[model samples]
Target: MYGLMINELKNVLVAFICTWGLQLLTGITVRNPLTLLYFALFWILGRCKKNEKYDDKKGKMADILWGAASIILSGSVTFFIGRKAVLGFDSGLFRLVGILIIFAGMFLVFVRLKDLPSLIKNIFSKDYSFLAVKGMMQEEKSRKELPFSDLKVLGISAVICFLCYLPYFLYEYPGIMTADSLVQYEQIIGVTPWSNHHPVAHTLVISFFYKLGLAVTGDINKAISFYTVAQMIFMSLCCGAVVLRVKRIVGGIVAPVLSLIFFALVPFNAVFAVTLWKDVPFAGIVMLTGCLLVDMAQKDRGVWSDLIMLFVLLVLLSLFRSNGWYAFLLCIPFMLYFYRDNLIKIAVMVAASVLAVIIIKGPVMTSAGVIQPDFTESLSLPLQQVARVLVNDRALSDEDMELITDVIDTTYIHELYAPDFADNIKELVRAGHPEVIENNKGTYLGLWLTLFAKYPADYIKAWFDLVGGYVYTDFPYDVGNVDGIMANDHGLVPTPLIGGKAVIKGKEILIKLGSFVPIYGMLWCAGAYTWLVIFALIAVLKNGRNKKLAVIMILQAAMIATLLVAAPVIDFRYEYAVVMLMPLTVSICVIIKSEKTAKEY
Candidate 1:
């Protein structure tokens, strides 16, 4: 392992040398150094373990050359296949195919095509044995099943979870809220137009509870309070369900007890439970789904009931967030492979989920008069390009200026152009510009390309500035106290909530501790999540059952990649799903590893 680590560092050093060598030759400074570091880190984490196994067999030079070749091949393939999508895909078909190709190529290289036959044979074997698949199966079978279900563990854990958030619930009574709630609530109250932008599925949930509250008590505020309580109940139950499942697998009261504290008492998570946001409910459901996935990963054979529940959760997951569908897209392929024993069942579920999304988001949403979101949301890179060009004060002819103005109004670019954010520019164009961006995409593409060719460094700088938060640790603290605060200017009734100063101070202190703490800070930053994903990948490559749970890391990687191209800002809420899953994930991995070690003894 030490030798393998040394080789990986040597590969990175070679890449670093070649990087500066190119800069010297071309006199063009690298645009996104973090991006390079990110890719190298990803490569190291994923491939280093495999290198360790092969180190004694392969010569040092062979190891170095192989690593370098792997890096070049992966990068070149991605650049060539994804270039069109980078400019912009005219059809969803192109983007979907491009992503599929990328993942396929990635799997082929990462798994080594030379071993394909053995891998497939192992997967299809009566008891899949590759990466200790059969060992995990044996462990599952050897475990004694309890004669009766223990509802007490569930009850106790749920109560603990509820109590953890009680302080926030009491302090911020009804909820720690935000402006987005009011925007979403307007549609539920029938005072504003309905739209899929806020996701009608979640809006309908709020509306049902609101009307239910009114029918019972005739007080709207009571409904808000009920809604907040309902969120807490749901989250608590989900956390409890996951803990119970873990307890069943590991056969310990202590680990389960500690798991409860981690889930219920973690500062950010505890505060997050009472905050009324669409993400809260979405995250709660995601946790429930994760439990189901974890159960499925441990068992040797198929369970029809669990499959049905997983299908339901995946559908709900895709519905609650706009980006949820993308995450699902990245997961389904792996699900097929991981559950290869139940190919037909997995296929049916995936197909049904996809069809449901198409029908609901297309015809159902359209019938309800849900206007499509702005085009600029999808054009983050292009918008950043325009902003960068404007910031440079580049000299342009009248025709060039006119061409740019035809796509985006250049007047607001000066004030709205924040290198680290795309929302300001996106909002400017959505407010004033015409919706001919798709129609005149060629012209827009030409302008973007011309600017890129002219000021590559500036474009690179903008990309890094916007995306560095996810890949680098020092990219400014942007996700501060977004929860536990209400929008004051939106004319919503003033919250009766008081003494929030104390709560705010508490949150600020937690954030600072997370940011500055030496070893513990990995739980806090965007870059830390990147490392978590990397660690999960290493765990997956080392074991196949681990792969079942760790495959979600692919979704994490894809989500982060999407953010690099499309996110408006670096918000912690964006990666909250990862935060919620990390503890449970580590616990499961540790338990399984301990079991394996005991068996070895």
Candidate 2:
């Protein structure tokens, strides 16, 4: 017992040291104490003897060495692939290297056969037996006979979600509460008008109704009405799909009910469902994709259909917002790591999708704009800047950080940053505005260099801070009102009372009570923390060892991390999909646990 305790302590120490090292190396700042607490738990459990049997010193040594090597190799391969692609080389070499490293790592981790009694004992120990039993029971219950009428329950849930958002679609009272939504709407108009910046799937969907409404009344307002109604209908459909998917995965009436409550109660969902914002569509698409991917990964069926659907969804997500591309990139590592068996097919699908995107949205389709250059010419520089900020020992002022972020966002020197370059090249091809395009590119390049030369540390600090902020803040914080006491032009309501009063009137109302409520405002945070605990426990206990589910959990967690690092700026609207997923995943875990427990008895 003393030895076991000592080992556990060592594990905890390792986890803490590793986590701190990662924070320093990556320049990530985890603001939430809960996140850190979870990490600590993860480290201790991950190193527990029952979870991992490293009986032989030689084997343990090998495990450590190989694990480190595999990680390094994977990183190196990814870097080479990115570099080769950026440098206009045939990226196939790096792709091959990446594939080889991935396979090698998998073999090192899971392929070696071990048949020791201790290993078997470790796999089915009493410590984990309860969890296993719970998982089994849940699986069995989910598989049990179900009444046909339950399908109707899903429909009802969908209706409820739809009706909840009907008011926004039906009426338009301009106020401060709706300001963000209006800004998004205006942004859409600026980009794609009528068709808007919504995911192509959503915009196409709205366009269909708008055209129909046009034929009936030929009025923009009526067309907008049709668009709004379609959004509500589609959102309802998304909710229904979520309910059905959760029901199938978890089983029981409780699962669906809980899922409904969780999604329904979120203020973001309620408010944004009616407003014409891209978040609803983005959430719907991501949720649908997540459900499909989970089903495909877990069930081992519908591979082809799921892949096709995923492709379509990816295109829609990408077109919805630039950030959608991150979702697509995320899938690559997941497939490589967890679905290695389906690599060839997944690769084909991914390649085809990429080709389609390039062909459709490539320079050929849109008129190229003039190129601009800035001081942050190399990608490495921005990354270095990020590293500096993350590792900064001193405290930073809000203004200093904000200035750094603005610079980083504009001149990261990536292809995506060259917004005007394509336009310029197109004009040059047409012999129109050639000088303007060249000059624009020079101007951008010069500005980027100036920033790099003048404020390198500040630039780096901003990059890290931005990434850190995203990783840490599960909820939106008022940037203009840091310390939760100041007010600025960013237009966040000055106080809960004022913001609520502007939206809802009545002196007796508790306008921002949800912010303080345990189950309301903090639900997402709680759910996230709970998921980490449950997932780590399950992985340790060897309960419900479904690789697909594990992969999904890992991917979701990683995506959240990536989003934090890459695009930390989140509104309630932006995080709605993630918010909804938390409760759903937790409910599934609970069902699995309960069922497994019941079986044990």
lDDT of each: 0.66, 0.50
The best candidate in terms of TM-score = 1
Looking at model 1, the pairs that clash are: none
* TM-score of each predicted structure versus truth: 0.70, 0.55
Candidate 2 wrongly placed segments (more than 4 Å): 1-150, 167-211, 301-303, 367-469, 473-503, 506-511, 524-544, 591-601
Tens-digit per-residue lDDT, 1-601, candidate 2: 1344465566555444434323222323333444365344445344343444568999888767766775665456435442342232235763454344334433322212222333446557744431133333434444443353657766888888876655433333121124434333333244424322334444455557657877898764455466667666777777777777777776666567777866565544555565555666777776777677667766554478888997897777666654566656666676665666777777787888777766655553344331222222213234334334334433545554454344333232333322212222222222323333244555534544555565676665555444433344443342111111122233322122223443343211222333322223344342344345347436523665455555445535554554544442343445555655554566556655664567566
Please write out the lDDT profile of model 1 over residues 1-601, one tens digit for every residue.
1343365565544334333322222222233234345344334333333423544645667656665665676556556654443234355764565444443344335434333454445447753322333333355445544333568778788998998878767766667667778877788777789876766788888888878877887877667777788888988888888778767756544457767877786666766777767878887777787777877877777787887888788888888887777888878888898778778888888898889888888898888798766666788777887788787898766776787677566776787788877878877777766476777888778878887888888888888888777777655564435554465443434254545577767766665555432233445567677666777667765753556766556656656676777777777777777666665666666665775655654
Which ten contiguous residues of candidate 1 have the minimum total lDDT? Answer: 21-30
Assess the local accuracy of residue 94 in candidate 2 as a C-alpha lDDT between 0 and 100: 37
Worst 10 residues of 2 by lDDT: 479-488
Q: How many clashes would you count in candidate 2?
A: 32
What is the overall TM-score of model 2 with all chains considered together?
0.55
Q: Which residue runs does candidate 1 get wrong by more than 4 Å? A: 1-150, 248-255, 394-401, 478-516, 591-601
